[model samples]
Target: MQSKTSSYLANLLQFCIDNKIHKARKILHAYLLRTNQFSNTFLVNRLIELYSKCGHPTSAHLLFDQLSARNIYTYHAVLDAYCKSNDIDNAYEVFAQMPERNSVTWNLIITALSHNGFEKKALENFYLMMMGGFVPTRFTLASVLSACGGVSDVGCGKECHGVAIKLGLEGNFFVGNALLGMYAKCGFVWEAIEIFKGLPEHNEVTFTAMMKGLMETDRIHEAFDMFKLMHRVGISIDSVSLSSVLGVCAKSSFEDFVVVNDNDRNWYNVHGKQIHGLVIKLGFERDLQLNNSLLDMYAKHGDMECAEMLFDNMSEVSVVSWNVMIGGFGQKYSKERALEYMEKMKNHGFEPNEVTYVNLLAACVKSEDVETGRQMFDDMSCPSLSSWNALLSGYSQNEHHKEAVMLFREMQFRNVQPDRTTFAIVLSSCAQMGLLDGGKQVHAALLKDVAYTDLYVASGLIGLYSKCSKIEMAKHVFDELPQYDVACWNSMIAGLSLNSLEAEAFIYFKQMLGKGMLPTEFSFATNAGTTNVSLGCQDQHCEYVKILFYNRYLAK
Candidate 1:
């Protein structure tokens, strides 16, 4: 017992699906002539959704206008249409006109807000839905959790976790995964790990979350163990797992951990080459991030030739890859090759970021290409603070003390305030040039600008005063410092030795040891010719010599 209106609607739907738009419109017009009941609300809503899906929102709006009475579903349909077309404002308008709203209505609005980067607003809507007595489903919680994670709103994320637990939705696979992702991304690595360990069952998503969390916290060993556990449990690894492990391999300093036998200088190289094979077997060679990670791993292990080979074979090089190759060349002191890669990066339509410029500046500084460095600095369209510091450091390192001072003043004139590194470099320059007046001026400006005194800055200031032959001023800065590390004491000792005050240097060295501070090479070297053999060999002094020897050997 199919009604004539239903039959006509079915035929229209079939015509719409078959790309017969004109035929469908003619059929609908004939139906309207034959039956007064053809303009039913359900029929109209169907036509609107069909037209909107067919990429004709204007026609959908026209069909929606012909409806005599709009139900909640009709409004929802139109709102969805507006959202699909990326006309969020019109969707909001349709939502506002709804006389009554349901959970579906609220979910749509929340998702729209999240997509538009209105994370705060999306969370607010979630709260409103709760106040309206609508119990959120798993989809609702997932969307809200994602929004909270986007803004790193740890407080709201915890609240959502509590709500999910109370609603007995914690075991829902999607909800659990989202919660883990939120905790991991928000720096709650310990909490994320606890959640993973306590999970009733583990999935691939669970393992990925735990691995990502551990990696984010710099617990590379723990992350690798988790990956191994995943393999033992027979869980399939995906792109994310491979990417995370590659990142760990890239950042881990293998030389520091791998103890090579006396006969084998190539031990670390062998291990790194094995890892490179694993990367190929996993078929991640085409992944830009993973490829760059492999390149970095090989470069760090002193296999620059293999690193270069990998770089040449990359099908698509990103800005990160370019930076890695450039930095590798810079580390090897190959200025010409580094500059050529930098030009290639630009020619490939990849704009250089702060890191790229920093490496280039370091290369220029090492090559003593002060003129070229200055040109690069001047050509920057929007120089970051790090960029300014690099240029100033280059000038200082090249013994252009006056030029460094000039650049500092020019930075101030341009309203670019100097950071801690800038002060450190400039103070070191003042020390080299014996510019007491400039040092004092910088000290005053530092106190005025820096809210908290850094130990490094204080040490630099002390070294500057001592080199300028102002030992009293050096003592004043040192005495005012609230905390003193070994470096601080080393600076003072070196300063005393430079002034030919060997006795004072030895005395300070004894005081540093009394404060439980260890002596460094500079400290030992400063007291090398002191007239205090008996003092040096006092109680447990043999142990001190052993420690010094060990540290010196390791340093070499």
Candidate 2:
């Protein structure tokens, strides 16, 4: 026969199910004091599960400790409670002591490991589960696949995919979606696309995965097309999907590709304006990210007016929005407007980040406003290397080579370690001034600091040596570079030509072309004229020189 304590406990369990958790807990506490027979294993586990489900793991743990006898269910309930509470360490400790473990127990531990950034450990446990002769379920496979995706481990992802196929879980929607996401994020774009196409019924998640994969691979046209396909098929695009496609549009709308001829220099305004219209029509203009993207699109396209309009109209501006506007005008050579906006940004209560300072310094450099640049530099609470590089490059471009070199020395005195850009600007200035001693000091500092091995720094060193009329030193630096990019090769070739090593420049140019690296217009013009003059054809050389000079004039 049921006692009063049993009836009261049953009522408390019913109260918990009916969402009266506080009342249920109160009644349970009253019954515990009213009767000693209520302290049973079943009653305690039920209460623990209730507390765990209600998002109170500490209460669940306290109840578990009060139990006189512990079972596998008791351990599992508390371990799951710890997992839900994001206390994986305590969960693992409990798992370590459970003498009797089941498949559910293993799954709980694996999930805890996966969610806590222990992807490799999670995969290892999944393998352990399989070797222990337990058949993997959809939940187990989904969790492991998610871990693979998080780490972008393609080989491990492929192995998991094979396991899923063998277990006949590949066709399951949740498992299939996880596989698609894993392959997409791992850069297997084609494989992800194939899987997406093979789905018998594609959901919103399926479309989003394919679109994101295409965008990541820089297939922007295909991503946009897939977005249209989603609309045509009546699949509603969520905020994530819309945001992803808009990001692609924003990127493509601002990216300026260099063309060899003046006529081929296509402006980005049309695409940028279209995207802006679409953003407005879609009512995403108020979104901070979309507004920031629109500002970037206009700034990059040299539409300062549109950028300013968008920036001013933004109801809620982020630091990024201000940075993009300042940077956009800076890129378009509107130095005054850039600086003004930066000042206004501060007035509007936006504290300038590192990016803001970098953009402002770049504008000061473009305008050759050294005094203003110096003032800004000195005013910085803590300037980064990028800010220093901008000022130095500006000084170099304005023919203030000595000042730029002096600034490098000052930076060294301040213990601000120079990065590759720092080395590039200072070396460029040293080359312009023929400061062999200063250049050598910088080289020594680079060796000591151990961050100057990048190709840009090596290229700058070569240019410095060539300008200082140390062709042998330039060649030595070029030889020591770990890898040569197009810019590096161009700098070396130009350096050789500038120092009157026309034959060597021609040879390097040929090597660069053979490696499928296209020469810039300046490189071609400079090298062709130099080679012609060196070959003793004065009139032909002069003719090519005239054409080169005229081309430069027109480019400006």
Candidate 3:
């Protein structure tokens, strides 16, 4: 009778596992517990697996704790539960307590760490696993490779690639794809292409990874070619790849498309529309992500008509879809239309998230509606740093320099840390208002943060000191920069010209050319304006300066 009953319950548990009948599994769990069969290790492991697979991590964990005679299978099941549920801290805790681990054990924890953004920790554990004399499986190498890519540690990733080759698993489809991804993410597009060529079979994932890598390296022409190749070679086109390709199209300017088609400024619209037509032809029109991409592409290209039409047709719209519409209209300076859409979004039961408010704030910036922007910002449950930066930037851009400085002080009083954008914007405001003391305080705060190395912030400081007749302070900041981009060089030159030191400004401009830094229109304009400052000198010397300026900058 006991044997028959055991067979019946085992079959029932298998049914629950196969069908994912959570309630039935729970009933079976109770029965096992009541009849003392819960002590049976095999039956308990299966129950734990069923619970884990069904997304009931708490129950699975409870069963794991209740088990008196746990084995490797028991630990694996519970570890999987935590990993799948993204409970990384608990997952690592379980791993730490495991009596003995196999390759599978290390793979689970490593993959979880990689997926959860602990890339460094994942790589650290991979070496520890190697030192433990546990050989990495194909899955283990793939996970470790992903961690390597996340951290952009191409050196370690190449070593892992060598390990894969030594194990004769380099050509294995899963490991090969991982290698492609790692190389591509590390900015080694050529290396990724070599792996892609060597792979015996190419799937949608493999093609998408290659396309994204190519795009990352600004090889958009090659990426689009890959997209065309995917369709020609009969590789299945998925939403992710299509969305990525559409994003590239949306962001591309006429200059970007000029190489593909000469002098065609409308190529962005044409390419976006072609992709939209392809999406419809391929029956992906109903795909929410693809539809959102279509909307974004149209919106970015300033085709609000098509964007709205596609947005209306989306059967299932996510918050991202709503945000895209708002951002699209906001950027086009259609403030009223953006606000209408925000109202409509709320009516559709979507609460305005941080991104939603950020878009609205941007719209306010474009329309110069500072009051409305402030109201919208205050409405946020907890305004993010980005929200603060948006309003602060709006103030600075609109010439409300005093208001910007005041808002920045409020940001500091609230204990909200400012990022690079915050420092740059506030410093600009101080420079504009000639508030040297306030700029110094902001600069002091910036020095305590990593944003001191930022070129824009450095330039803003240069402008602040130069405007206050403190050219020495401005030059000190310029000299202290580890490297000088064109902006910093221009700032230094402008500071000398602003302080009536035209000869020094000329020397700095020549040095800028010597350093191979390209002079922009702003650099030319700054130097040209200095010609006026030298008018009181000797006529010959003034003519010499004018002739030099006209020849060097105005002629161009």
Candidate 4:
């Protein structure tokens, strides 16, 4: 028969495990003192574990210190408490002071180090643990595999897999899942697939890892195929898997639907509807992040009607929900609706973030509503570089070159520290207004910023110089690019055509083709005027002219 004191101690420990002892804690401590249960090592260790899980690591450590004769379990509980608190240094201190070490102790420290971004250190400890003759368990292998994956060390991961096979843990669910995640993240897609296939059981986490890995490596179609397989296998779908699938669907092309009057690049609206139904059936419609994904899918799929309906139906909405609506309206050039929602979002007690202002300003630009854009700019409590660039973009897009230059000066006065986009838009404004002196000042400032060599900014500088009739400077900027893309080549060609240097344009065109860059439609459009130049370009490049026409027709 159990004694009354022992029964009470058992009940107290159960209360702690169930997280129902917060108010009764003082009484329980008083009773423990009265019953002399503090002398029980098992009771003390259980209290430490309980307090740590309850987010009271300090209390757990105090309890551990109060023990007159601590056992291995007491030390393990305290170390775990410190690790849970993210106090890795303290955990290491406790770990080093342990008189005897076991496999569990090594695994705990290795996992804690890995979790805190010390993957190299975690690997070192794993090696040391083996040298000390402690055999690695499934938990130990999982942690080490994660460390290997963190550093993208495929060789180490493969060696770990060989060890798993020797230890007969290849099909162990937890170990198999960890190995799957390891190989997938390390870009060993085929090996990951094989592990995933050989798994004795599959979980939602397993599928999500495989899908994310496939998506990361640009194998989108295969990911979708795997997703369908999961559905066939009746594996439960969750928000993460749904989100990944929706993202891939958005990027997929719709060549098969082009003949059916579906021209949107993202024709995934069909698949989106099916997934939305699943979310609803699973009673996850109230999930904030899942709702956000559904909203983005609808907006990008060109189904604003569905997006607006979903927004209206949401009883519990977040700021991202409102941002999605604003962005969708901006996409449709509906400035009024976007502006209305800006107020609606504020009324709902959410302040507009940088993305809100970006969408609002973009809508204003499309509608040529410069006054609203200026108002929005003034409304920002602390305008960032993105805000200033947004206004500058609006001015440049509307051909308000003089106003844009004025805004640029104001940006300098406010010390906002213009970024790459700022230089691009401001240089464009200078080119339009033929402000050669201002363009030169902007160019001088750009020379000091290393980020200006980014493709867009460099291209804008080249075009600006050509428009100001400074072709030499344009070439100088062009020569400085470390690597050139199709847009970089197109900008150079456009500069030549603008300056009536048809001969130079054709020579650069040949150079671009020699670099194996397929010319875009914009490329042909810019060079279309070169044949009418005064250089007798038509007589000089008659054969190439015909080839251009053939390609242009194909582009059409």
lDDT of each: 0.78, 0.79, 0.88, 0.83
lDDT of 2 by residue, 308-346 (tens): 777778899988988998888888777888888888999
Clashes of each: 0, 0, 0, 0
What is candidate 3's local distance difference test score?
0.88
Per-model TM against the reference: 0.63, 0.65, 0.84, 0.69
TM-score of 3: 0.84
lDDT of 1 by residue, 86-120 (tens): 67777788888889999999988888877778789
Decide which is better by lDDT, 2 or 3.
3
User: For model 4, what is the error of residue 170's alpha carbon versus the real structure, in angstroms, after optimal superposition?
Assistant: 13
- What does the lDDT come to for candidate 1? 0.78
lDDT-based ranking, best first? Answer: 3, 4, 2, 1
1-556 per-residue lDDT for model 4 (tens digits): 3376676677677777687465555566676678788987877787777777776778888888899889899999899988888889989999998999899999999999988899998899998998999889999899899899899988888988998999999899878988998999899999999999999889888998898778778787787788888888999898888887877665555541123435754344466677789888988888888888888877665578889999889878888889988988887889999999999999989998988998898788778898898898898888778778878888898898899999998877877788888898898899888899999889888878886688888898888889988888999999989989888888898888888887788788889889988888777666666765636557657556657768667666
lDDT of 4: 0.83
Task: Give the winner by lDDT: 1 or 3.
Answer: 3
Better of 1 and 4 by TM-score: 4
Model 4: CA > 4 A from native: 1-49, 57-226, 229-236, 249-268, 281-283, 346-354, 447-450, 531-542, 548-556
Q: Choose the strongest candidate by lDDT.
A: 3
**Positional deviation of residue 201's Cα in model 1 after best superposition, in angstroms:** 2.6
Off by over 4 Å in 1: 1-136, 143-152, 255-275, 299-302, 345-359, 365-371, 384-386, 389-556
